[model samples]
Target: MMNSKQVIEKIKEENISFVDFWFVDIFGELHCMGMPSYSLSEDDFNDGLEKLDASSILGFKSVNKSDMILKPDPSTFRILPPDYDPSRKNARIFCDLYEGNRAEETRFNRDSRGITAKAKGKLKEFGLTHSMWGPEIEFFVFDAINIYPSPYGATHSYGGSGYSIESKESPWAKGNASTAIDLKEGYYPSQPKDTLGGLRKDICDDLYRYFGIQVEAEHHEVATSGQSEINFKYGEMTEIADAVVTIKNVVKVKAKKRNKVATFMSKPIFGDNASAMHTHQSIWNNDTNRMYDPNDSVAQLSQEGRYYIGGLLDHASALCAITNPTTNSYKRLVPNFEAPVNVCWGLGNRSAAIRVPMYLKNREKSKRIEYRVPDPTANIYLLEAALLLAGLDGIKNKKDPGDHVEENVYKLSAEKKRELNIGSLPTSLKGALDAFQSDMKFLEDVFTKDFLDAYTELKYKEYHAFAQTPTAWEVSMYTDA
Candidate 1:
């Protein structure tokens, strides 16, 4: 809660020798650079900590063409963990990128953080105060993940026997080696069966003690080998996004120290449960919870809350381009496997894309709607901002999300589903992108046309690159013919 001047004075008082300016690209890749704490005077902090050339950081230019600026957000200041360097402890702040003139006419097209800030301002303009977000980030820890690519061949190994509780070779392996569960079936097992139990605990401890992230819980997800999920307490939209990047970094660093690899690649292993960062969100009006109503309401969700879900469901297809933004993300959206493919909300139903969790009963503050489309690979800032915008649009327009289908939607006949007005999410990245292109008015407040155009160009290039690659399956099926 300290101002920029107070933060600067505190840094000097704490004898912090250096300050690391941190930021992320549109793809959620973290970037950092350091400056001497002596250079971080009170005036400098108030004026903003500025740096040169963030073009590379924004994926806008190659090394040769890079030229941009970074200005630290004073509120994002924090002391670096002791373990990163025991001596000469460093302070850090997340930064905003800008281009061109600093005063009156700075062209800041490439700043993802700037876009998010603008989005927040727009939300305020629309009379929405605070947007709360809880991200259930899921990932897989592997004993070894080897990727090799050559002109003649390519191979990757996702270690598993399709059915196994304990790996004979895993150091964490213990009892019940003979009674292993099948692939994508490792949800909430005990010690020996859950190889990553100790690791998850260690990761959670580090997040709390080091980064100060309040982890709600950590547990095994529905994937046999090394799949896990860690739930953090709900936070302000931007704070949650920042926490996500920090959490991922901490997990990977800690895993590497223990000779393991962690991945958020949505669908790292074929025929297994894919990772998803299912987001739960709610709106608040000062001290009151706008999304909660204990009186005559379906599933205890307020009328405004239902409208928010309606907005999300209405724009769900376009939302996926930002939320489930990867080619691998599509692999997990298929029917079954507890993945929510249908665009509907229901209480205690896993088949619905939006589920009002029954676990938080009697806790008014905990009431929220979960959007299950997002994966960990998304830029959390953009995803959260877009969802907020869409939901606000729905509320503003009084859009109704309609009846909740408690029954399994997959089992319903096509005609029956049509009668019920159930719609499935986009099955491919291209489809998602196409949907975004047409139905992304809500995003315009945050994502400018230039940002969207550049992002589309970059993603399409990646898609084409993947398309040009000859997979082993293709060779096996058609090389002889």
Candidate 2:
């Protein structure tokens, strides 16, 4: 990796006409400011970028008096592909924010990227070399989405002919062999059944060419109407987070080109499977796999692997705030829907929160545990980092998450589940927030107190906003009265 000065000199030598400084706000929205290439002198680059009123980025600013500085992380610098803007040659770099004159003393508490970097550092301090992550991000493509708000009524309607699976009014549904598929049952169906197969291919191709992300595969998800998933090869924690954001952006742009709108909302349609970002993770030592064991007694997972699961289950509630943070997130967590609501792990089981994948047949290097709670709407940086910290904590304590539950947790009797010590996740966003508040230590390890407080405040505001809005259900129930 080049130093700041060297990075700047190289950019100039390469004739890059624009520099894009990238950073994330408290809500994990990616923000950027661009500077002409001529303005970025070697001296200016060495001094680093500066912004006086960075409190605005905190998403909880009232006074707006805080001073903040942005220093670019040279390792994250990459040239923008020609496809995005052909005429203006561009390079992008992720920035680290500092609050004080002494760069080492001041840290941006709300900086998601910084928190992730700190988490990775902590992992190394505990003798771990690398943390791998594979996030299966699911999303919905709608032809059109309309939102209406008023004191008397509120409703949202989504319609589109491009990706609609089936409807009496849809011409494509009536014997249109090339695009027709059974509504709500299009999982892994190739060609004709996969209506958006071409769209998925285009999205993946653009992501790989522009961002250099290695896309493993993509397919139509179980949800029949426009639900899809793209799987990227596992990368380091931070890199994977960056890739997540990039992939989302690329997919949305592709959808827009085809007159469609893409959404990562956990649950967009009633009675349809919600979009989720099921994360698969593994810990690795220096060039060695730490989670794999050929001699394991159960599911071929080593002692370390079991301990990692123990940590995740123990801290699952607290982790929910970062993993499944939105109000709609709970709608997907309900039972009998393939979503894992029970705190347990099992081999080849989709009902368990932590699933030991059976797909890694004959591939020891690919062995890892799948954490099923997260959604694509989450801040990928914070989510992956928090999981790494929790797993490390587990290893330090040598925690053992006992025997696997082979039977479906939803099918188990209440008394039987109680005997087995199986616990359910929070039923609502409010419950998740409460859980996060009670378990502050885990979050504190990676985030400053101010950042956590600000984040909680923002989320509370969102919750209340949703609460104040009248839903269509309310009108149906009250109109008769």
Candidate 3:
């Protein structure tokens, strides 16, 4: 809640020696440039500018056009948590990417955070005062990882087996020869069975104390070998995206400091379950939550709420290119993992892509919808902005999302789904890309044509790269046959 002047005064009074000006490449990879706090002048605070080589970043610039500036947002400054290094007096500020050195510089078209800002402004302009997001980013922690040059080189050990590991802190560990948590059975056990509880609590505490992230709940996830999920209070689109990046960074650092490996890969194992980002969102205007109504036809979800869900479902396939951006993302979206595969809205139904939470308990302010098709690997800023835009379009068109399912959609027969006229989500990254190509109008205003073209090219290249690679299964099936 501190302004730039207040932040500067605090740094001086607190004697914070180090400051890391941070930003992300187009691929959502965190990049940091450091400087002594004393070296930063008031102009740095006013202009929000720093120079960098954009060519070094993916999806940014060619080698021939590498010059760029980073404009740090003053509101994003946070003192780095002292959990890992108690003696360090470090702070971090998130930056926006731009082309020129002046205060009125043009933002690089692919600046992910800049896109979020524009999207936030668009929401207000479109009659949605503010869009809020709450996401549970699931991840796994491993004792040790090793790999070689076969397939999955350098990180293959992380895939398939041995994930239900017994680490030093896990009560099940007896010098690495003890039993591990059984697959698909690691949800909320006490001390011994759930070894990740302490780590989750530590992360929650540190995130709140240092970064002011509002941590609400923390617990173990469905996967046995240290899969975890932490819930936090919702905020505006940009801040929530910022918190997502901070969450990933803080968790990775905290794990490393404890000799553990924390990974957010969607499908680390084949059978059990995979990590997902179930994002909850609501649109508000003039201090009123428009998504809910006390005297609605059903569940108090206003017509606007259903229309928004309709818009999301209408563009669900296209949105996947941003929400579930990676190839591994489809592996998590498949059937039987509690991840949604149907492009349908349901009241409290997990199998449906959009779930109208019944826990609102008639609290109009507590109303929102949860979209479960996303994963942690996504660029959060883009994903949040795209979702808001989709919902806005839905409002404009008054798209009608049929009444909620209220049942497990997976349990329904294919014929039954046909009877209800429900559609299914795309099955692969390629399919999602095609959908995005076809329905790009929803994103045109938010993600410019240039940005979309570049993003599509990069993603298609990634898909083809993965597609052409022969998998171990193929070799095992055909080498001797």
- Candidate maximizing lDDT: 3
Tens-digit per-residue lDDT, 1-481, candidate 2: 5677777777878899998888878666778888887787655554567754675665734554466777777877777766456687888887777764564646666778889988888877767888899999999876666553333333334311111233211234456656554545668877655668888998887777756888888888877557889998898988888888778877876887778788898887667678899999998888767888878756678888889999998888878888988888999999866898998889988989998998755467888999998988799988988888788778888878878889988899999988988998998877888888888676577877787888887887877777776666666678789
C-alpha RMSD (angstroms) for model 3: 3.2
Off by over 4 Å in 1: 9-17, 61-66, 82-88, 105-107, 151-181, 360-362
Q: Candidates' TM-scores?
A: 0.90, 0.89, 0.93
Better of 1 and 3 by lDDT: 3
Q: Report the CA-based lDDT of candidate 1 relative to the real structure.
A: 0.79
Report, for every candidate in turn, its global Cα lDDT versus the true structure.
0.79, 0.78, 0.84
Residue 253 lDDT (model 3): 94
Poorest 10 consecutive residues of model 1 by lDDT? 159-168
Better of 2 and 3 by lDDT: 3
Tens-digit lDDT track of model 3 for 263-294: 88898766768999999999999788999888
Q: Can you list the residue pairs that collide in candidate 3?
A: none
lDDT of 2 at 38: 79
